[model samples]
Target: MTRILFLFIDGVGLGPDSPENPLSTLDLPSFRALAGRQPWTSRSETIDRPDHVFRPIDATLGLEGLPQSGTGQATLLTGENAARIHGRHFGPYPPTTVRPTVQDKSVFAQLAPLIGTDRLAFANAYPERFFQHVEARGRWTVTTLAARSAGVRLRREADVRDGIAIPADLTGRTWQRLFDADAEPISEAEAARRLVALLDDHTFVLHEYYLTDKAGHSQDPARAASVLESLDRLFAGVLEAAGPDDVLLITSDHGNIEDLGTKSHTRHPVPLVAWGAGADAFSSCRSLLDVTPTIVELLTR
Candidate 1:
């Protein structure tokens, strides 16, 4: 059986390859190898090699002012035009109007019945504070809502200590500093290896990283560069660890870190980089709405 590891990076888009973009200024060899280009931007064209596929896909869902995460992530996970359904692109969290769609139509919800909940995993671990937030307010991100609907176990700090989960930052340092997590910090490459190792037990594993978006919003070039560099290392490790039977899918919901000119999301297209088994099937994806359906088809076919 083939396995899929979906890496959902938030708030990244193709921008101009200039000083405003750390992607343009950095030396990320792994990204270059997988994407077949440097500083993937508007000028960058699609690369369809025999072993990999890379291209920019639309994040703006037509009726958009600026694409927001709530609708964008919902669409990415559910294969539905969430913004259109809700009559606008809405935020950092899913709106009440879009919650039902995320709960029912998300890739996890759709796949659980076909592949069994046991075969699906959301690889990001949560802190105790997050669980308390869930209990107190009941607000959830699109990804968590989807996973919850499917009865997927939301990983926790113990999962990280057990080597079964990866932190959102691709290293435990942030968790240690912020939450006083007991897990020792590991290198980004080691984090990638841990994520890839999940394939042994799961048919589909998803890891979400939002610090890119946070850094982008900060308009701090150094912060953006640091996050991108960590991702570069993680990507290299995944490529090294993933076997022929595993497919790696990388994409984002909206654009932010690509251009530091503003503290807002851009209308720029986000990159979709796919490699390993059944990667070609994803070549048809042109927007956030197409991602979940492509994965469903690939996994179910």
Candidate 2:
């Protein structure tokens, strides 16, 4: 079976390769080597390598406003024109009207029957407080809703400690700071190993990292670059650890971190970086809606 490791990075886009863009300022050797290019920017055209591909895909979905996570993520997960269905770009969370589609047709939900729920896994570890918030407010992110809809068990801190899951921050530093727990930070290499290991028991594994978006919102160039640094290492590590049958897909909801010029999400196109087995299947992806379907096809075919 072909194993898929999907990394959903929020608020990243292909901006101008300038001082303000971390992809330009930093040396992402792994990213560069895998994609066969450096400083992926607005000027970057499609790169079709023998083993991988790197390109920008439209995140706007032909909408009229800055792309927002709600509709953007829904569109990515469900492979549907969520923005049009909702009549507008909708947030940090999906609108009530759009939640049903995410729950019923997300990549996880769609793949459940074909791959079996037992073979799908969401690798990001959630803290106890997250569950408390969901219990109190009945709110959930698109990823979480999708996972639950497919009966995929959401990983927890214990899973992180057990070497079976990864933290949203890539490292456990944020978890320690937020929860005041006695935990040591793990290196990006170790996190990569843990994530890759999960494929041993499942056919598909997904992990979400959102701090890049938060850093973009902060408008702090240094902070944005720092997070990107961690991600660069994480991606490199995953590529190194993956087996012959493992395919890796890295993408984002919309553009934010790539350009710190504005605190809001940009109208820029986000990158679609694919590597290893089945990587070529995504070379033709033109928009967020194409992601889930291509991934489903990769594994099913």
Candidate 3:
């Protein structure tokens, strides 16, 4: 079986090969080597190697203004033109108009039947506050709602405590810092090991890191650098752990943190980076809308 580990790194976009871009500032050897010793540039979009493929896909969806997370992530997860359906780019949460698409066509819902729920997982864990917020406002991000509609069990604090799921930071450091618990930070190698073990049981596993988007909006250079630095370690561990059959798909919803110069999202093309056997599976994609369908097709096949 072709096991896939889908990595959704939020708020990343292709920018100029300049110091202003945090990605350019990140001294990540593993990621840099995957980029063929280049920055995340338009030139990198042309890159195609056996084990790595770096392609830039449009995030704007041909609409106006900066692409927002609600529509962008919805489009990526459902293969729907969410921006068009909402008549414009929507924000932090999905608008009422496009919520149905999120619930119905999300990759989680689409693949549940093909691969069985037992063989799939959404690897991010939610905190108690998130559940409380949902109860208070009855809203959620596109990914969470989609998984719920598909009957995919969303991981919780217990899952995190037991090491079955990871927090949004890719480590439990935030949990330790925030809750003042005795939790030690999860190492990148351990994260990679846990993810690989999940792949052993699941045909597909999805882990979302949304802090990139928050850091982009905060426009804090120090914060953005910290987030990128941590992710580089986790990514390096993932690269070291995953093997030939373990297809790795790393992508983003829209562009944000890449350019801290702007407090708003940019009209940049996000990268669709793939490794292992799955690299070729996304060769035809050029936009966020192409991601979910391609992933679903690969998993179902």
> Against the true structure, whose TM-score is highest?
1
Kindly list the per-residue Cα lDDT of model 1 for residues 1-301, writing each as its tens digit: 8799999999989888878987778898888887775557777779776457898999999984999999999999999999999999998789999999999899999999999999999999989988999879988988898898889989999998998998888898899999999988889888989989999999999999999999999999889889999999999999999998899999999989988989989999999999997788888888998999999998998
Better of 1 and 2 by TM-score: 1
lDDT of 2 by residue, 55-82 (tens): 8999999989999999999999999988
Off by over 4 Å in 1: none
Q: Give the TM-score of candidate 2.
A: 0.97
Going through the candidates in order, what is the number of backbone clashes in each? 0, 1, 0
Residue 100 displacement in candidate 3 (angstroms): 0.7
| lDDT winner between candidates 1 and 2 | 1
Model 3 deviation from native, Cα RMSD in Å: 1.5
Rank list by TM-score: 1, 2, 3
Error of 1 at 19 (Å): 1.0
RMSD of 2: 1.1
